[model samples]
Target chain A: MGDVTVTKSPDGVWCLCRLVRERLKAEVEEMKSQFSGFRPGLVVLQVGDRDDSNLYISSKLKAAAEIGIDAKHLRLPNTTTQDEVLQSILSVNQNLSVHGLIVQLPLDSVSSIDTELITNAVCPEKDVDGLSCMNAGKLSRGDLSDCFIPCTPNGCMELIRQTGVSVAGKHAVVIGRSKIVGAPMHDLLLWNHATVTTCHSKTLDLPEQVGRADVLVVGAGRAEMVRGEWLKEGAVVIDCGINHIPDETKLSGKRVVGDVHYASANQRAGFITPVPGGVGPMTVAMLMESALRVTLCSLTGGRRHGNSSGVVNRK
Target chain B: MGDVTVTKSPDGVWCLCRLVRERLKAEVEEMKSQFSGFRPGLVVLQVGDRDDSNLYISSKLKAAAEIGIDAKHLRLPNTTTQDEVLQSILSVNQNLSVHGLIVQLPLDSVSSIDTELITNAVCPEKDVDGLSCMNAGKLSRGDLSDCFIPCTPNGCMELIRQTGVSVAGKHAVVIGRSKIVGAPMHDLLLWNHATVTTCHSKTLDLPEQVGRADVLVVGAGRAEMVRGEWLKEGAVVIDCGINHIPDETKLSGKRVVGDVHYASANQRAGFITPVPGGVGPMTVAMLMESALRVTLCSLTGGRRHGNSSGVVNRK
Candidate 1:
């Protein structure tokens, strides 16, 4: 057998992340000249900060800073009411300076908050997180050029593009149906002309289903639930899952793993993403890309130049 | 081999149609008693009379009359401008008397009209046709209760329910990706807990795809494309295509057929919908159902009680 290719090395992810950020930085500098010191702005709204949420938000903030975006962290008290959370979002929605808004999920609140309602409160135009129904709807209906796609799936597409395997006429199996990942990924792939099958928790014979995939994307949230033996040899496998498994050797006594067993899966897969270095950095990178696009569109007073095929063609 | 049971016999459709109409008639009569002669109203806006459109409109009008719905045929001239069409829909959207509205497609206008733009203008509230991006988006995101599902797929689900085969966990294969049929059908089945695979023109190995389905839905618009040999034994086949083929014996020198080769498919399929009396009649029946639902929801001053599971559980 030929040597197996790891889809993304730690260095490779850092390189790609650096590439996207540097490009954005250059663009931001160019915009400063064209628009009289105009800066693209983003707001990350968080409530009742869960530790994991804080960590994720911090990563996003760090990325935004690196890319020269005017980023703000709008942290609310843990006891913030739903209406109060909504008011915060609405204020950002009306803020002409802020071009992008993302609500940090799993709101840590003493009061019962409706996550869907809160997510939908962000205006579709500024919804860089792409969780709002309006944006999700636009994405689902093959209006890829017109809506903001969720970050993970968008990043996964970018990774798949790097593999140089044409998505058209390929069999794409998406493992999960979460609004954020699996569902939109299926739409993106289908519009790209792949025959897409979505398999979830209830899917009987998961291995059998995964075997037919030329491209398999797993966001099932289960830790290494998909075995290497289930993969079709030489398939392009993208693991979106970030599960924590205990390991006595580690200082934290736990190690991060993806939805697929990386060690075994790499033996069979033509390409596979490592849990830490693969989709994680790319997700943050895509968020920056989206934030930049939103900023540009707002500044230009026009819509995002949507690609009809739903695939990012940017070199 | 097991007996090949036809999904919808002409008599069965007639019976089902009558049952629904009679129930609707009773409901209308009850509403008359409560609201003092408030008849459920529907407006069918037709632009440029294609004969097929006319025939479909006539059937809708007939069905509405039987159900005591005050159905109006709003016919516009072939030379009508797109602006005029939009104005017509906008006026209907504001009219309190009208609860449901459908624009007959293939706008036979002399001037080029943006169909998607016009379809979106119908106001999601009155869009009984469910072609609007808003409704399509809601349906795509598994928000089945909050959206009007396109009638054909809605009716297909009703037929599938009638078959007593559980959709959940089943491998459902849908051919085609048109917004109205295949795409929506995929969403509907996926939400119903089925493992759905959507195949279109770009799909490789169509037969292999078909062979794996526990439930097969074909709406490729190509006549007799799916042969019996491709089907898994006892597969429940739902054919949504209506293509006219040469039949010299007929007075019109043509006959209607489905995407599946019915005669041959019956040999392998445990349950299969016939061409003329199958999905065709059910589509009309579903349109009537949707119109009635919109009217009832309007009168109730509350949202229609949406079934989260998305299957029509009405006996």
Candidate 2:
């Protein structure tokens, strides 16, 4: 077993993340004592049998249990109706007990899903994932200091903070521009002081842009796509990709690798998040954090955790 | 007066500005056929004597008259009520005759303006200037295929298309991420296929980021802020800055210049929007285009002008 490299970053801001976590622990403890009636619950609906989705769900359930959130997992048949899926979401959306609802994606390619309708149907308050059309608008407008940001990207941010990298004034390169990861990631980085360039399949020169970054995030799911040479010296890296590759050495049929070749990149990375232990862990943690925050706010008459510091705890 | 640089940009794209003049001409010729109709009414509300606001409103009114649109101006006292100002917007919103309404901003310092409420209350369909919150949300969601876009930025885009510069796969660096320009500009660029980098006061290294642009748009309104030396060779520059400096030689007592030090910038630039003949005129033309589009959409069941290749009169 290889222990990952976990060093203090030279160029980023780690103390900020500590401050945020301190505030989170403090706020959650305070809420537990005072929020007598508060019980934050999150319901996740996953369909079919994708190993990735199952892994994501289990981690979320475990995180929810560890934090004081109630996470319920419901698996539906791949042949479920769009109406049935929407009904399940609306049920959780309306259930006062469930503060948030996340409908897991990759619905069978055979059965078309109306993403817009599902997103629009999510109650804005319980949109802890913050993927709803209304919440997306709030983020884009840069007016939502109180809005629930989507988990994975926000998790990337929490990690960035932990690394002690000041995003504001840094050159952050994002590989991929999907609505969930790259697009929202760019906006969040821009909000935090990073000048961001997003690249995708059509990007003219991939390495040139990557060469200029002070911080790099790769969400493009091509295994080992970002080589060690593509990084800026001492640049902080957050790898969000999870690709399963055949490995003869693995106990399982195959092993998982990230978008970057870990060993070589870690040697050059000032701070980097290892695949399974890094962003994957932070995402579920953030979701639990979001659900708990939502519960506290609803209990306190639609107000927030009220930490003037703008940091709240998941646990 | 020194002869100004004029790049007569070719029109007819997703930008609504190009269709305004020809649409207006057609509407005027048909005015007699529908005298009972509202004569395409437009009302503009002004709060103060800010020179720039005066210039913009005057240009709009001049263009409205030339097009035979019912042009009406209401100058409210600097001490206008939030309700009173809102009432004007309300009346216009309710008025069957009025097809478009504009509430000029930066209300006099003597009277605090309720900009948000004003923006929130305006009808999205008639938000010709495109500052309404509703329109903003729609645009950010990539829903502008049916919404009114802010005009000056739209005009900036028309210039690019006129140059036959393909937006797809290009990089756009937008300086000054204000609600009116930067935010919408970012979304619009994405819609058109340009990877966008947005910068504000908090951004780390200004010139370093600016130096890597394929297209640079400066809307900070700071005179000569972007030096000629900062631009990438052969890059197109759109200087949205309109500043007044002491000019003893001019009768107006001051002279106008753009954010770019144009003479120096023009030397290295492949294309640029000059202080007078560039974005300024194109903005009014776009507003007229928006009004005409709004009218046609209303008459034809809220159908938008067709996507980039909108209804255009070649002659």
TM-score of chain B of each: 0.94, 0.87
Predicted candidate 1 versus true structure: per-residue lDDT over B4-98, tens digit per residue: 33343456655655665687788788888888988888999999989989988998899888878889999999999989999999999999999
Q: Which regions in candidate 1 have their CA more than 4 angstroms from the true location? A: A1-10, A306-315, B1-10, B306-315
DockQ each candidate and list the results.
Answer: 0.73, 0.42
Q: Please, what are the lDDT tens digits per residue for candidate 2 over residues B1-315?
A: 012133423222223343556676686657536644546778888876787788888888988888777778878877777778888888889987788888877765356676867876778777887776556655665665756778777778766666667667777788876777777777777666676777777777778878878888888878888888888887878888888888999998899898889888877777788886678777777777777767766666754544232212211
Real contacts retained, model 1: 0.70
lDDT of 2 at A77: 83
In model 2 chain A, the worst 10-residue window by lDDT is A306-315
Best by TM-score: 1
Task: Supply the DockQ value of model 2.
Answer: 0.42
lDDT of each: 0.85, 0.72
DockQ of candidate 1 is 0.73
Docking class of 2: acceptable
Prediction RMSDs, each to the true structure: 2.5, 5.5
